[model samples]
Target: MASTMSRLMLGRTLERICKAVLLLCLVHFLIMMILYFDVYSQRFDIFSRFNNGRGANASRGPHHYYYNYSRPNTTFPSYLPGADQLLPTAKPEANRTRPTPKPIPPCPEVPPGLVGRLLIEFSSQMTMERVQRENPNVTEGGKYTPTDCRPKQKVAIIIPFRHRDHHLKYWLHYLHPILRRQKIDYGIYIINQLGEDTFNRAKLLNVGYTEALKDAEYDCFIFSDVDLIPMDDRNLYHCYDQPRHFAIAMDKFGFRLPYAGYFGGVSGLSKKQFLKINGFPNEYWGWGGEDDDIYNRITLNGMKVSRPDVRIGRYRMIKHERDKHNEPNPQRFNKIQNTKNTMRKDGISSLTYRLASVKKYPLYTNISVEIGKPPPRPIKG
Candidate 1:
């Protein structure tokens, strides 16, 4: 009976020890589960804030987290090790838009309307009114500028006139188109000599140069005869560094230069070149000696004449008889011999004339002036 009682007590003690060990294992498992959930929650919260709470699974894996960190304006946590090396650096965004660029202006070296060779035709039916109607772009004072582009130079055409209405009409008909094609900003001035007292061609040119300056600051001055017209449009009326003689080959001389020293018909002079020569001689009353005297002045000033190629510098002369009172001066040869001595005193500085009137026609500016007669010749003993 005593042995049975001891065995029952031993079994009870073993059961108590086994229950204690099971309770300790349950507590350890619960603590481990709590710690693992706390770490996962903290990581999820960090990713949500980085993605602006767009979605819970926005950054699920390491690849997704790296892409979100590389986005512009994203803030990376400093506690994370080697975080900057996991993604590429982002560029800053621009605050404002870029501005547009302005367009460049056109160059005026080569004109678009230039037709190299022209067919020059004259008709009795062609009138000044018709010529004015065709050239509607010409302003009140015969001023014109190309519509397509700015001109390369400002030119003033000075035509010494007495009478020749028909020739003037033909000149207007042909030249206006040619000048426009050459792309020159130009004005036409018809310097009309009043009265019939020995037509002084050179003095009228001086007056034109003086009066044209009052109108505008013209850089170039082209002294042209009312009757001459260029056959080729390429014979530009613009000035050069030296004096330019445009009428190198005229139909009157069978398309050949009459002499080596001929500087007549149409000539271009820059402001500096004209001033250096003191302008044309005022004592030349008739047509013959004035051109030669001007040539001598050009040579004296150390500026050579610049001419275009012979084929391009061709001109046509209108057929007309000499004027009534414009007889050849008897003392032309003697006066020409004294050019070097008399040029300084007998040019633009000594020029004097009475301005009759200044009328602006549709085609040209007519400047009529009264120039006095030549001094009486002394009788030979």
Candidate 2:
């Protein structure tokens, strides 16, 4: 009986050991399968999106373990850990490549006849935007463009220019935009005196009128001082039936013209009216009498001076010392009263100036004229 019982116990122990070995083998197989799937399945999933034909169960006879994890119809894996050994899934298609992009067109060169139009178009959009933002009541798209711009029948812009570079810069910056917005196809002539000979403001203006007409016909002439910048764009540069004193409300006189006949900062004249009074006197070299002389000429010709609403004609005078050449003459007033009487003898037609040279620049042409010395004495005869 004892022997039989011991044999039975040994048999049971052997059966238990066999069962444990079978369980260990099963766990090992599962672990290997897990490792293989973790390593290869991720890459297969990525590449499967790009290619639709490569089957998920594609046969890999020797590496059949990886075949089960292979996923097709997916984007190719760019940086698979062991992918350096594998071939790249996608290749370049010679016909599928794209062409290079083209360049944009540049702005056209500005022409004299079209300069005003170009300016109008350039500022039109910006002006409209600004106007709408500031005043909601104003109409949109009303800003004038080259296509819609109309040349004023009789308008002129005379700019008195000198060595003040700062003044010129500000003048161009502010006034150009203003003039374009106003849509006045006005000729802008800067009467720049070339030399240091007692800056003859009035004579330079006469030169501008002559020079401007040579380029294109302008029926009206505006004598404008460069330093004065207008506060209002509404103050039209065009002449009314009467002479227009556009710069009546300048800061120099508390934004108001000091007297009734003030036409100092800027004044416009029609061709018939200007020629009727024989234009501005070429004799007054210094500042004071020239404007007064012009005023006298207008009054003498039976035309009255018209003014803007004093509220709107305000202008800012750039601060600067009086030009060295334009030393204030003590006798300027004496000559001012005589301009009307002497108009026929000392005007544009009677004036004489030597043409030094003309340099045609890339932009516009410049003709340098040597306006002869101011008469030794005022023409009081």
Candidate 3:
């Protein structure tokens, strides 16, 4: 009977030990899950060595990460793309040279006109000179850094322009105030195609990007059409995990998305993201297929497009007739259908353009370039 009692006590202790182990495992799994979610949501990209506008983490000290353990090695940044150079960086330890981050500007209370719609009466009263007079905050070379403080991202606004000064006047009037209210450091570059060659929207965009970089390092580029303007300030202009389509709703499409993959009108792309796909194709001359080509490039590179909710992205396109010598490219259809074949060879890497002139106005910078001509149309294999 004593032997039987000993067996019973030993079994009970073993069972108790097993229960404790299971409980500890459950607690550990729950903790791991919480950490995974925080990192996934990008609440903080702590390991992000430089300022990719991932926001600040005050608790991070100089020795947060170490290569040699004896001393902090701050020489090499993470293996981020080339575009990462556009963002700011923290001061490295021991006077190491690194890009310093710009300060955060104060967010002021800015009101919009009636649900963010521009009344004809209000907009008609706005003039180009009036807009210029209102913006006294611009720095040298038509750059606007937020007056109250530093800004989150340094943005370069690239407008593809050949003509349409009247449309541009309206755009400057509406967009400048909206961008200022958003409190971002930005500059405007109006890329104009020189001479009477067929309008190559994509090549000009490539030119705009290269030229803008020559002037200042831009974290992101907003390729905006001079004729289209956003109605709501809520549709913020910034980069994300993927490219973003700001014109979610346009009057041209009856105030809704025209199709599933339409990434036209005003759009945003970080430099790294743009470079990953070699930028837009320089072969998409004229107006028809460049935007679609851009969409395909993004998708092919394992990135998806993101946009604000439809209600937030409402925009109005200023109506106009097609400009003289700007006929539709007959080859757009064939090129778009055969994107998978030509994309690798015909993008920014192969882009060619001659700088004709660069002019800085009170509102923005204007860069005129000779994009030359598109190669003879190719036959499908």
Local distance difference test values of all predictions, in order: 0.85, 0.64, 0.79
Q: List the residue pairs that clash in candidate 1.
A: none
Lowest-sum lDDT 10-residue window in model 1: 84-93
Judging by TM-score against the true structure, name the best candidate. 1
* lDDT tens readout by residue for model 2, 1-381: 999999999999999999999999999999999999987886685565324224443322222122333556653244544432233333236645578755433212222332221111122223323433443322221112233433545344556566765565555556655655555555555555667776677777777777767766778777888788777766766667888888888666887678887778888888788778777788777657788888888888788999878766778888788888888766678788677567888888776777565444221234566776665764676
Put down candidate 3 lDDT per residue, 12-109, tens digits, no spaces: 99999999999999999999999999767563453454453344653255323333334566344455444233323544367676688786545443
- Writing each residue's lDDT as its tens digit, candidate 1 over 1-381 gives 888989989888988888888888888889989998998887886665555424555334453453354578877677654444334342224644568855435535656667877777665577888999999989988889876666667899999998888899999999998998888899999999988888998999999999999899999999999989899888888999899999999998999999998999999999889889999898887657998899999998788999989998998898889997898988889988888998899888888999989999888899999989988889899
TM-scores for the candidates:
0.73, 0.59, 0.68
Candidate 2 residue pairs in clash (backbone atoms < 3 Å): 48-72, 48-73, 48-74, 49-73, 49-74, 49-75, 50-74, 50-75
- Candidate 3, TM-score vs. the true structure? 0.68
Candidate 3 Cα outliers beyond 4 Å, as residue runs: 1-127, 376-381
Give candidate 2 regions above 4 Å deviation: 1-145, 357-367, 377-381
